[model samples]
Target: MNKKREIQSSVKDESLIEKRRAQMIRGAVTLFKQKGFHRTTTREIAKAAGFSIGTLYEYIRTKEDVLYLVCDSIYDEVHARLESLDIEKGSLEVLVTALEHYYGLIDDMQDEFVVMYQESKSLPKDALQYVLKKELEMVALFERLLTECRESGELKMTPKEIKLAAHHLFVQGQMWAFRRWALRDFTISEFIQTQTNFLLQGMAGEKISTQGAK
Candidate 1:
């Protein structure tokens, strides 16, 4: 995915700009979750951020800019966290760990994510495209991980299988968040356990039980 777009700012200190925008994103996520994008106003975002309306405007030009920043920050956070995983071994155990890690991260950000999915349609066309591109990059992460497993002989997928499986894994992780209310009966641990087992059984071509997953 492309690097974050340079939002014009009056502030000169790059570090300060990042710091303020981070605050704005945090504040905006809260409001978006509570009141949604259409109902939330820039003044409310400024108040939630513990800053003045004028200061908020110093970093972003519009409320839409704040929304774009929130979506951008979320994808960046997910990418950074996934990059921190040590999954190079490419074993079944490593694969299970990676899935669990990803699903857990998704659960952790369920609200912001749901907001992103629901409100991103309001984003400008170019901003929406950038967000969608970031999503493909996430899918690529899973594909690369699966490729590693295949090379190590822990998986038996063809290239097409690897690509589709990667999309499956990525979307399924988000499914847990997007369908949280319908799945309230299942704990995160149970959800992860069942999904991991289901995925591994298909990918490994054998029933590899993760009995200890719960």
Candidate 2:
């Protein structure tokens, strides 16, 4: 619904664009997650989105546009989930809690995440960069939280370290979905606890555990 998001479509009416795109995105994400972007056709996406093939074409010129839309939607959902956490308190404990919440979301949206990553390469250069920028915004959320901790003197890390640490945490959450074939033996809870423990301890000199803390 955000106009700022870069989505190439022929529809010009903002409200119509939002409504139809919403419908299209809901349907497309399901099909993409289940059948993958390469296997999904525009007709199938239009049917799933409850629109005619003609209507679908009015909005998108290609199936790749649907893939771009799906990737954008996934990023928005993940960022929204992470933003829902209580991050006002920028202590190490609060950061760990946020990480746990984020990891849990990634686990729940495993199929979506997998689809987003696997299909992102199919997007046009501009669309792919848009998605990547959205990813950076999510990373910046953690970077801001880390900055808060530093400003409060509760944690100490260099600027670049903070950036890389935020990036690392995001990657760790993503690993749950992408590496599920090999990580199948571990439950989401186990994965979160183990990862949070390593990240917390590594980020701070203290022995921190978000395992059961949340």
Candidate 3:
């Protein structure tokens, strides 16, 4: 498990800290989507979160801390959604369903996804590394599923190929949010169907339509 980076807080109650931070993340992510991280002020974040500036400062010292918290919350949600998939079964059908769920997640959180993708780089060095590590944890979920498929003879990929394929799968999901202008013509289901077919064809050498999976 990745150790969460300790954010300095004046509050003593752990549950209160979590509760306030969730409010902070919800508020900050919206402002981040509206105004890029550098342009948004800590005062604005506090107001958006329905609290005073002093209350926000009690939870975080710097605006960057809020960004880190937002990024952390986003990854936690993404991991929870992906973790529920039947990756252990390792069939091509299972893999395709996983991709569908992942793409759907990205679609559902497009604003949040765009904010994290664009503003995460503004975090401090340590916070940025923590966020990147969280990203790899997500990729590893896909890697494990792909490895299981290979072990079960459902996918004919070498270990190296599996690693690259997993990274590709992770990035392709991000493309929907990162390049929405280019992909505006494709609906979420269409995007899922098209990408799943492409990925499965390369990994399993069999084309599978995910239209029904949509």
Candidate 4:
């Protein structure tokens, strides 16, 4: 009975630690997004997280460490979402649906995504490389999806064209997050529908409509 109680106590402590870590990450993401990484300080992050500077240091070594943590978490979430998508069936429809889901996920993680996008270059060499590697993996995932679409005859672009198109498509998605203040007036479903139609019609070798219709 004593051993069982001790085990329960340990589990509770671990859960509390995870809760605190998540809170810190959430706070750090907001600060980093609002004030860019260079402008934000560890002390600010600590205060925002409702913890002392010393306690913040106990969990994260520096402001950069917090950036890395936030980015890693964001990327992990994206990778998980991508992994669950069924890219093998109805490749074009799957890609459209996956992209819509991707946009929603990134929108939900807007703070972290924005911070990482804007401030990853400020990291030290090794840390910047680590972040870029994760970003490249994401890029490759999209490229693969584009390639599958082209091979499946769902898209008419050549390999080189597909790669370029994928890059542009990604940039368009990023614009939705980066320009959310201006885009906030537009709903996510509207943005997804508009963007998806734009990409699909263009990739299908059709001319883009000026009035935003396919």
TM-score of every prediction relative to native: 0.89, 0.81, 0.91, 0.82
**Which runs of model 1 end up more than 4 angstroms from their true locations?**
86-89, 211-214
Error of 4 at 191 (Å): 0.2
lDDT of 4 by residue, 1-214 (tens): 0011011112335667567668778888888778878888899989999989877766655677777677777777778887887665537767776677678787788777788888877776777777677766777677888888778877777778877876777668877778899987788778877887787777886643323322
- How high is the CA lDDT of each candidate model? 0.86, 0.81, 0.87, 0.72
By lDDT, the best candidate is: 3
**Model 1: per-residue Cα lDDT over 23-44, one tens digit each:** 9988999899899999999999
- lDDT by residue (27-120, candidate 2, tens digit) is 8878888888888899999999997999998887888887777777676777777766656767777787788778888887787788888789
- Best-to-worst order by lDDT is 3, 1, 2, 4
Query: Of models 1 and 2, which has the larger lDDT?
Result: 1
Model 4's TM-score against the true structure: 0.82
Q: How far in Å is the alpha carbon of 116 misplaced in model 4?
A: 1.4
Candidate 2 TM-score to native: 0.81
Best by TM-score: 3
